[model samples]
Target: MVQYNEWMKDVNDDAKLSSLSVPGTHNSAACHVALPSVQCQGASVTDQLNHGVRFLDIRCAKLFLASGDDANDLQVIHGKFPVKIPFPLKLAKVLDEVYAFLQSHGSETVIVSLKQEGQDTWDNDSDEFPKVIWENYVRPHQDQWYLGSGIPRLGDTRGKAVLFRRFGVKDEQLSQNLGIDAHWWTYNTTDDDRGEIRVQDFCELNDTNDVQKKSDYVKQLTSQAIQYNATNPADPKLFLNFCSGSNFFNPECWPEKIAQCMSDANIQDCFGKGCGIVVLDYSEKDDYKLVKELVDKNF
Candidate 1:
């Protein structure tokens, strides 16, 4: 039997990050006291990591300080709302949790997908979001991150947080070393192939009737990842299949409801195979069944 906490220890060091089946959570740190629409996860980040989830979908909103204060910070958010109610969750704190987990479990590596969420009032030239992240969050702890632009081997990333940057860069030099360039990812897409990374993030469900369509997209991407990895094991593109969606206006199509619908869609057929990163909402439901099934594929 594979242990949830240290499951990566069983995987071979030569395995590429893009080829392995990784379990991930969408809005991973949004498990606090927030509205149902904003809260996408049921378990805390620490719990997710301990339960064999190697990928984290973290959305950070840049909170600029006073006029001249250089000590700006990034707060975790979902869409335009803060994940936590009154007191917001900070990205630095989340990174600390990841680092602590890696220190204890030296064989495991966590892929953190960082996206700039919420409104952007700051000027792009004066305050570029990627540059802010690079200076404020990443530069301070550069050693703890895998900032390479290409897919990394598991051996090279052990005990490190692999950065999957989802924000754009204005400076030409900053763009060169700012992690895997998922900056050109399309929104609410069923299939957006950007060479190094492919995405299936069809997040808009017009109604409950659209759940099946969403599930179909999930399965299709899963098959693509499995087939690609099986044939070209040495070089594989990272596939991020998001099994999360909502209608926004319809309460029935909320995240939890969509998650329940997805749970019943018999999506398990996509599991126990190399399907890249399976990002889910409410991943803790059914005792982390989705995470466990995906993790088992490695062994």
Candidate 2:
């Protein structure tokens, strides 16, 4: 398995994350620290308690692979900070593949971006995330993988999130699906009554617009995660679970408010600085994947 280790941290609220920082690692994608922008580059990290994660400049980023399956050779691409940086061509290709694969999975996840909580120019709307989502809105649907997780951070949580936008969206149909605003990707290709269904199929099967939908799904999933903890306060019960704000997908953290209350009683990763904090139920994505499979097969 490709285990990702922390590289380094400098905790800067100003740096725009450029090339000089990463002189060694082949940069493919660089994420802006939604909270505390660190100044360190690629430093091998494993300890969960390391201040590196809390370095909070960027959420998660990785260098693209070498010239193999994923290669583009692009000069530089825009980052979450709207700053252009060098990315190995091969790495960009890998990101594109990951994006496609995620789209195909159709699972939802609410990303607590570690980037600075400020507006981004690339996004024209009121805020960066909403703006980027509005134009690139990929409305979440039933079968998509993104719908899997979405929730808000409790207590003194940090990090901001942008619901990644989707393309090839329809107006009314999408509106009905998400119970949110509807905006298509410009023009429709066909005019058949079943066009919406066909379009959905295309998006799901080809994974072309998978990133948009998956990103949206995650936003919604995380935003509403507190519901899982919706147990009666009078009869409060606590379950030994782990949470680092990412516990929205944890099984015990379902139903929103109930789960939040449950998490409040247990341990927390201390805003991700430490790791022994139990939120609701501590598990990995596979936990939900199994649940999703069971639900698909049974109910």
Best by TM-score: 1
Local distance difference test, each candidate = 0.88, 0.22
lDDT (tens digit, per residue) of candidate 1 on 21-123: 9999999998999988988988899999999999999998765342433325778889888899788788889999999999999999999999987875656
User: In model 1, what lDDT does residue 33 have?
Assistant: 92
Q: Root-mean-square deviation of each candidate, in angstroms? A: 1.6, 19.8
Worst 10 residues of 2 by lDDT: 18-27
RMSD to native, candidate 1: 1.6
